[model samples]
Target: MDRRGHGVARHRDLSRTHYRNGVALSHETGSHETGSHETGSHDTSPQALTSVLAASAAGARAFARTTSEERSGMLHAIAAALDAHAEELVPLARAETHLPEPRLQGELKRTSFQARLIGDRLRQGLLADVRIDHADPGWPMGPRPDIRRTAVPLGPVLVFAAGNFPFAFSVAGGDSVSALAAGCPVVVKAHPGHPRLSRRTAEVVAAALREAGAPEGVFALIEGVASGVAAVQDPRVRAVAFTGSLRGGRHLFDLACARDEPIPFYGELGSTNPVVITPSAWRSRAEEVARGLAASFTLGSGQFCTKPGIVLVPDASALIAALPPVHSGPMLTPGLTDGFRKSLDELSGTPGVEVALVGEPLEEGVPAPVVLRTTAATVLAAPRVLELECFGPSTLLVEYAREDEVYEVVGALRGQLTATVQAGPDDDELALALVPLLAEHAGRVLWNDWPTGVTVSDAQQHGGPYPASTAPATTSVGTAAVARFLRPVAFQNLPDAALPAELRDGASGPRLVDGHLKTPS
Candidate 1:
């Protein structure tokens, strides 16, 4: 115990009362340096939780009522503030996550870029997804009533910040930004792995939104597992956005579904992003593919959810030989480190799987990369062990004799965030056949690029089926993610005065008028 008091770290949270109470308790107990992990328990009273939810609901009301221009202004302000605070933030992120400065800086940049991107989308009012149908006096089904529809906010949203992406998936991450842009008040459940950074980031975001004239509670930050569970359970929370593991996200999904008034839980879960290499492709650019695989898998100590976990290769011999030494930096947390070790053991213990290249040993908290070899037959027989996401810098290489075997392996896959197929120019027919199969199993299918780098753009799809994400039809990244927090509302034969602005004729967003595409005038 140091003399500075463990209360200092707890004070970083947005809850001032709790901070003071924690400090007093620490002093009373004669504790010194207990750390935030010990004293950071933000078990707020049920009344306080309800109050937070109430404020969020009020904020949602205001947010939904605000014009698209207003929301965009706030989003742009948030982007600018993130950039202003980058110097202060990246270091804290690096200290907490053990990620290098350059990577964290890029991530912070991406985080801000994502926010601004949403703002730009909002300016166009594309997410409104408006439609209008003028009443026809001589319609086939008699006289038809004027029908207009546009999406509206789903009210308060609870976002579960992810640990691996300290900046991009943390407090100012995609989920929260999308929810906010969709006009839903965000209550981010700070990831404990980077609580200090989460709190700081939250402060930055809150200030930005507030300065941009966002209503109180438009953005709120809360900590602790209990708080997160309670936020999801709260009736005011209309929908949720989550990004993490299958177990963690599924648990929250279950809670949301079990509620009396069930809400949509958009959870981006685990993925064993598989990359299949054709025999021809391997022969043509084997070294290039090998190096890219190594870089993608080991990027960020393989902490990325999209880190390729399984590589179905025609031949593992060359790729195995090309694999770099198993050296890697520390994982995001000690718990993840242990989980990765257990997964490594499970794969190593499996009957059909063979250890091709074992990485060099490292100190605790840092995992050595591992590569396992198997066949398409082995994978089909024991898909559970082989297909399951290991969540670290290790991958399984499955050898296939025929292209049909590749199809079989792809068939065995559950939903995935991404599936990559490297086909030589001559293997076009095979790729054409396989792309469709891969599309059925994954949200995003790449021809030659790795899935590790998810671009924040209009076209990006960062969600997939089942274990990859609970809501396959929805994305948790990119401009499309705003749809998760918005539900469609139709006004039939409504008076001119009652029509929403976006649904009114000549609105500034893409629309479908009488079942025909109409650009905003």
Candidate 2:
């Protein structure tokens, strides 16, 4: 099949190349190959690993010292490279993920566009929030020192790739881009489900770096769960970016926190992104609410972290009547499909819940979308029902009878990435009351919009408290994502020549010096 004049091809198996350790790995672009295990551990030669790490570190330091213009140029190069390699990557991603071609293609574009957007932001010096504070007469003592704030590299970063959006979240995706732009070297722990695709993307990025004259150690790609653990624990690694299950993200978070010199771990863990529909809103636009919820729940087969897992509505019948028919679709992978089936069976057998929509099971690798329904009182009483993130095309509707109960249930929600409210024009009171409450419960709150589509813009917030993310104030999908890898240092008094180039004043422009903003001659 051809998509937009680009020939869509299936993934072709490359010959396996064995390493000295007897572990076998495949090369996506050339005959040269390396070995790494899927379980995050490997017995590979230390020389190969060292070389990769050194190159990545060099790239990182070079990026750190680079002018905003240089960094922006490198990002543009990355975008062009990704566009050039889309054909090969999309097909490999599809074969590895079992996702449709169109979805993969869309993701490819999103990923490339995100890189370009970051480049644009870099050129604008978004991270360099240069502020000048002058002496004020209102000061109690002497003149106040000028204070300015700008982001700096957090050093080497370790990115744990997510399984669902391999291209967008993998080796050269948002996490890596943000970190690189912030002057941090990146070491990516490739997702096991799409290691080959990750390797290919990594190569593309490496080529871009070489062509752009990026320093070594700017980027490295490693596979295996053990290697991931080691990378996070490595003292050289200063920060972490991860998107995955709560269990996995928390483990890395704990590991980072327990380090001798602890570092920040910004993880976008799983979320049961909830949507609350007030009684009045439901009465006014029950059908509209239902259709919107249906689309949000099933998009990407409910694989998105922002997928609405639970709907709080007053009328169960209205929600049921509005839902679309359940249909089976290929999940991201066979293992995920099986896992969803087991979860569905377990939830169906629960005492208070009833299956609202169910379809016949498909072959072992296919997942059928399902919708389960239960009363608000029952769900509130048994909060465990709301805790589970059914990571497939499934949603549970919890019917509440009163506004107070809806508020009570929402208040009890664990930290969430996003909480959405669907209210009509007439439901002003409910909407007003719910906004602050939802904001407190999640990192981002939405009004009359689904949370599944995350924009890579400055205003976008992609992290939440606790379960939604380990760090609520940090985001994984916007310009702010770079902050996860940066730390600020204050400079009391230092000579202008001693200051870093970014802090120094020159005809070139204003620079940061000894942690303060200054212009050097």
Candidate 3:
């Protein structure tokens, strides 16, 4: 891929294939080439790849130059277009993801809602201008200049679509919405596992852009891992947003940082989203918490990144008495299901852990949620047991003998997207103390709610530090996500004609007037 501000300029061979139980369904022949400057040896052809990348870059530039009002209109139009295409997109996503129709439909709405939220925020201009002041009449200085800050586009962004949430995190998902809202162009690398669905969604977004008179290059989609690598490493690509495995995200992060001029890579890596049940809450609502936990662990076959992989309960007898038998549906991929079974088998054999509930794996594509119970001491001693993420319908329940031990284990947790507390009215102090601790360890903290149902609201925080996400201060959900795609610039008393149209003070364009940034009235 060339780094000439056009999208990726080189394309390699690319195709979509299915995998079951870790084996490819079909085989095609192609020579694998590796280098910064080799092209045209792949089956998909380099020219085609280059065109796609160029088009994507063009779209991003177009998106960046558009007025905030225009972008808001486009967002609404995109949402409407997505709703119209639901009939076509839903079934394809279901077939590719192996998720039920209802779930896919909900995800589709979530994707649309995210676009709409971005649109609403654009109309409101939430990130336009924030102010800070330090003025003292007694100071020797006659006057203090107002300290002001505002967001600006970061440039072209490369978004790595996730295998799960094909719609909600795909071509028109949160990453795309947030990036576009922040005035950055978006180039999405379609997940190989769901290429057809991704392609169709990309078509919907493209159509919406054209209908809204938006730039053609504001959004583009490409297939294959090599294409993604090329896009991220290219100089034109200023930032990246990804939702996937730690290994995959870390690899991209390393590549981005390795550049002589490194750029930011904001990735939401894997998380063992943990839930803590205080003694008071558990005693009062053990059965309710147990049932809720079961539902979360099994929801969408536990494919959701927010799925709770670990549960902390202080009392084993209470937890055991309240818990139900392990129940689950089919996982997204057969390979993942098989891997979960293998991991479970391995962990079950570990010296200190006990199998609280075990269910046989279903044929190939299906998975049964399994619940394993162990003590905090054992888990702390066998730290390797905590390191692995069982990416399927399974959860580990760790019982703590004392509240202090719960705090210790919680402290030991690595970064996470969310950490939930099931607290009662009497547990306010514990909740307050835990909130800050959880904030340190997680991107979002919840009380009396499940982490799976993330809302695309203004206050939402969907990212965390380190392993949970590469950038802790940023979010992958809600309007603030757009900030990830933006960088700040100060004009320093430039003339109106010299300023970009978006920043010019005129009948047309965005401007800061009397300390308030707004479109001309």
Candidate 4:
């Protein structure tokens, strides 16, 4: 039966795939309770999970043998498939996530664009990062043997989908796509927030890969917390990619590490992106800064990993008055709502914290924008309390008496996805001082801008130190994200026939020969 329309066929498509373990299971497998939104799904049993991981391990070797052109074609196919199903996917996502139609549509576009962008780069040989050093009789350090180096796949990877941006971070999101581009088979652990959406999206992806002639087991989607944990501990799984809270990510990170053969666990956990306003900048454009802050902190109900959780300004009295009131809608999940309320209550009860703007009391699931104020000294004294994340449409305003206090507050911040500085021409000294300090704690540093909208490009860095992400040197966005699944290997003194095509003599790719960058025709 064709898996296209809204009817019994759709429902069958949902249950047809037994690979919920990695490979398809028989139709007789017992059903497992998925969630309130999604029912009649089988929780991947331990036996099935092992079979799935083994298939992915086998698929990884077959996928690695595929030429870059073949991989690029697979990516293009996935992107086109996503675009074709937008009408069906966008509504399903909105229903499950409660996100507005425009937001869901835009996110779907961004997700597909990421796939195509990586495809374009792969064909250009940019993703491989090839390098060659020819043998030299006389060299600076001594005779250097002929060495050819290129990145290769790290086998199977397990990805944990994020909750907030279902399309951009779930199922066929950046992590899954990037790993596939690097020739590694991927198994995405679906997020509970949008299980139905996850299942449907996985159907589209699996079909696209099959049509594109990708090897079997190149991609799969598994449900249930047990499946995720078991996948992490499985020896066949080589690496893990995750996006979620600090507690959850940390727990998984530990599990991945405890494996007999520990694998690399790349987790984008939590971030309290802080924005600094120099005295001169605040005086010059208080209202403009205030408006930007209000919109940014409330974007996506402040659930973005890069949301500015804390903002430091010179005068609370002037800035507070200029700030416009903001109201946020319901969050994505009931669990998220409960966590938001708990975090807000803790901050509100803190002795030094005072309410600056409280639009409306939060109802059971609906969240309202809130702004709290406290002195820089209080934050400095109790960094544990003031400098934590409150994942909602709220920001803690830390009033600094002098420019020196701004430095102290930034210095005390945890690893962050982003750090912003609002400055004017007259505040050059302060901006220069803060930029370097912010760089130490954040993956991406911004100047006179908010950190809400992250661009998908080669230069973009979406991961930071420790709490922001497990792997700081790598990124979870942009073309570079593929690097997380690729490990470098050097071939020394290999004959032309034995060397990989990109490293062979007269090869075509972007590479360095004798320490000089070269791009072939």
Candidate 5:
């Protein structure tokens, strides 16, 4: 947003004061730019976290005052700046996260592309959702007054960066992009696994925002688990976005709900992302199905939040025989490796499940890709062990003898980010019945495809119910993501001059009018 127009200068001046205070405190405490230390710990007292969050709140007010055009320009500028500096960011991400250079390069581009897409939507005025009701003199239930409804920014957001996909889900990732698109300032709790990379990425992002004329304190970076907890508890932090394990996401969700005023916490928690294959699908393309499942589960060492953890098949023998070889690789962090190993042990130790295809775990920390098998009855008897998300390259194959058994197994599953149905062209009737069932359990239901890669677009949904995500109504990806950071305000009996510009009558801009989407008001 431009800092020189309207009363933007005055607002920026106030935000500058707040920003200067945070900077002074950071320097006084020998802190990294945003209170992050080299060890990814809280290098100073609680004062640093408190000051940075408070400053972010102050800056959010300035950001919320910006129009769609200003923020759109700023967002595009940030994307350009990121692409210009990818040489520094991508290699740093690769070094810290152990991700391949090509993957990191693609992710860096995706991250910026998503930002640009959100910016485009903002410029097109899709975020406002402005609705205007004309004043009526003789109404059925008394006189109908002028009512103008528009969405407003939900104040400052605390974004908890994820360890996986450092470029796509870390410092300047989806959470930060959507929050900024909604005019909410962000204080990112950098993922501890990639501390140096997170800090450097924050620097590039901060510099870009500043150059794009964003108000000071509009973005910040912080470290330490305590600081993250405190961030959620802080009164100024109105909302939070996170991507991590169920344990971590649930902890943050609980903290948000326990706050004095409480707050909305949108977390993309782990998912088992179950896939079911029809007998025909297996008969027609058993090898293809096996290869797809293998690649999906083993992608990025199976660190994806939406990794397909379970596969339901009419006969497990076909898939087991067709299954291709998969190799395990190093996990993101040591703690995660330990968790993956423990989860693997728990699943493999289960009474019914048998190790179908165990990949090579050559080192103490690294575990190979593993595929376990169990019958539908056994899964029904022990759902928790079968349902839990194993963080590494592993999956469970549940064999069902009948269609009823397939439904039973899928019915026992919890909410998920995605669910795939490997069906045939002749299975329309069955697909119709089963698709709705999967839709009820997942945010996105797929057909004839894998869910390893997520496309950042208008219709994408990267969220689901509890265990999969904290907020089912919200998505952490795509254009709809901006909606999480926005709350609707209805101004009653307001004159054209009195209403917000977007809500005024005859205002020729893109927005909803009288509940219908129309261009030029």
Candidate 6:
């Protein structure tokens, strides 16, 4: 099979063989179901997957019973373990991903930091949205009975590790961190692009959770696309999370919905991340905007989900001329490079599209940066043909003559992860008019800034409507991410003894009591 664990079935039965040289490893029969089967012919059989999912189902209950303090310790332990093994893990990651050592190191550090940050936020009572109402006969609505509500963990979550970000978006990344913080068990499906790193990373995480006294099945890792598809359909898998191309995400999402008991599928699919440059802003700092646009779109060889695929400007010629040149760069995987090439070809071949600049030629397998320019009328005329995403070190510049065309173009856009506005002081009215319109189509709107770097914070919103994400009302980053794996349960007239600690009278943390906000004393 190819490194990405796809289109190859020869290794499926080697459930017990020791892996070497970072090759593909199947879900096996040993501890965590990671051992090879005795017959040596077992692929990720339905029976093996059932055992893994069954264990996770049991772990979900045990993890849910853990105190916030205990869960916090578990997350911290995971962070420490990742940091401690950075030396060993980074090299393996580099070998599998072809990413630089420094970039991998930083991404590993960020992954560990995200774990601890989620732990800190969990202890702060951010995951639990608690509300209580005492009996009030004179209530405006009606006679209100005693009621309490708080979020509860769903169950076992299946996380599909991302290929591009092997460290930050892989095994122990935000999706797993947030779900575990919310008291759910996690089973990560390894990405084929970096299977060796995925295996080692899972070993580290599993050991950390064990040492921290977490449930045995609190975390596990499996391989292969068939395994992932089966896991999504498994009843024991409560929810699913993913980060990848729209085609893959949509396929898995459809499977999740088609299950007997349909569950929530949180998929952060790629976005075009449109950017607009007002006439005044372009006139004032045309060079600056040009440089920033080039850098943002080409960052990480333009694999980022938030890469600015389309930029709207009044005149494309000046921005195109002022933009700095970029060199050819390596993409994460061969599949990705192929997709990038095909997308670029389709976009460049469009009838009205014009090539603005092409970067230095590089040998095969390495892609050069490209910039394409076309008119707003052309884009409006052929929205389906022109507005498609080209997922490499490339971008499209669409020139508009009137402000109304800006609105029309923005309206033509589907949901986006982010949309940016570069407006000068002289364009205050235009920026003001554009903010709400952009907000309607995007999850986050930026002013005079780029959208490539996503901040991990309480206010961070990393998801958008439709193709930007499977669940637009939720985020796959920040503290609020934990909320996705939790569902609210309200108890009406239940005895205090039957209530969760957070819902009891005189309980601690921030909560709403009789419609008034109260902090723990």
- On TM-score, the leading prediction is 4
Stretches of candidate 6 off by over 4 Å are 1-43, 361-365
lDDT of each: 0.79, 0.73, 0.72, 0.82, 0.78, 0.82
Would you list the rank order by TM-score, best first?
4, 6, 1, 5, 2, 3
Better of 1 and 6 by lDDT: 6
Give the per-residue lDDT of model 4 (tens digit) for 112-217: 9999999999988999889899999798899989999998999999998887889998898999999999999999887767877888899899899988999988
Write the number of the candidate with greater lDDT, choosing between 1 and 5: 1
| lDDT string, candidate 2, 381-454, tens digits | 88878777878888888888778888888877999999998887854698878999999988889988899998
Candidate 3 lDDT at 368 equals 63
lDDT string, candidate 3, 293-352, tens digits: 877887777777888888888776677667776666766554455556777788778888
lDDT of 1 by residue, 1-521 (tens): 11111011222222322322111101112111223332344434445566667778877777888898899999899899999998999989888777789989999989999999999989887777888889988889799888898888999998888878888887898998998888899888777677678777888888888789988778777665556788899899999888776766788899999999999999887888888888777878888888888888888778888888889898888789976565677776665676787778888788888888867545564678888888899888888964567777888899998888988888889999999988878546777788889999999999878989899889889888898889999988899988898898899998777888887665667888898998845
Alpha-carbon shift of residue 168 in model 2 (angstroms): 1.0
Which candidate ranks first by lDDT, i.e. highest?
Answer: 4
Over 4 Å off, model 3: 1-44, 58-62, 130-149, 359-365, 496-521
lDDT, residue 223, candidate 1: 60
Instruction: TM-score each candidate.
Output: 0.91, 0.86, 0.85, 0.93, 0.91, 0.92
The ten-residue window of minimal lDDT in model 4 covers 1-10
Off by over 4 Å in 5: 1-44, 360-365
Cα lDDT tens digits, model 6, 230-266, are 8899899999999876777788899999988899999
> Candidate 4: where are CA atoms >4 Å away?
1-36, 39-42, 360-365
Roughly what TM-score does model 6 have, to 2 decimal places? Answer: 0.92
Candidate 5, pairs of clashing residues: none
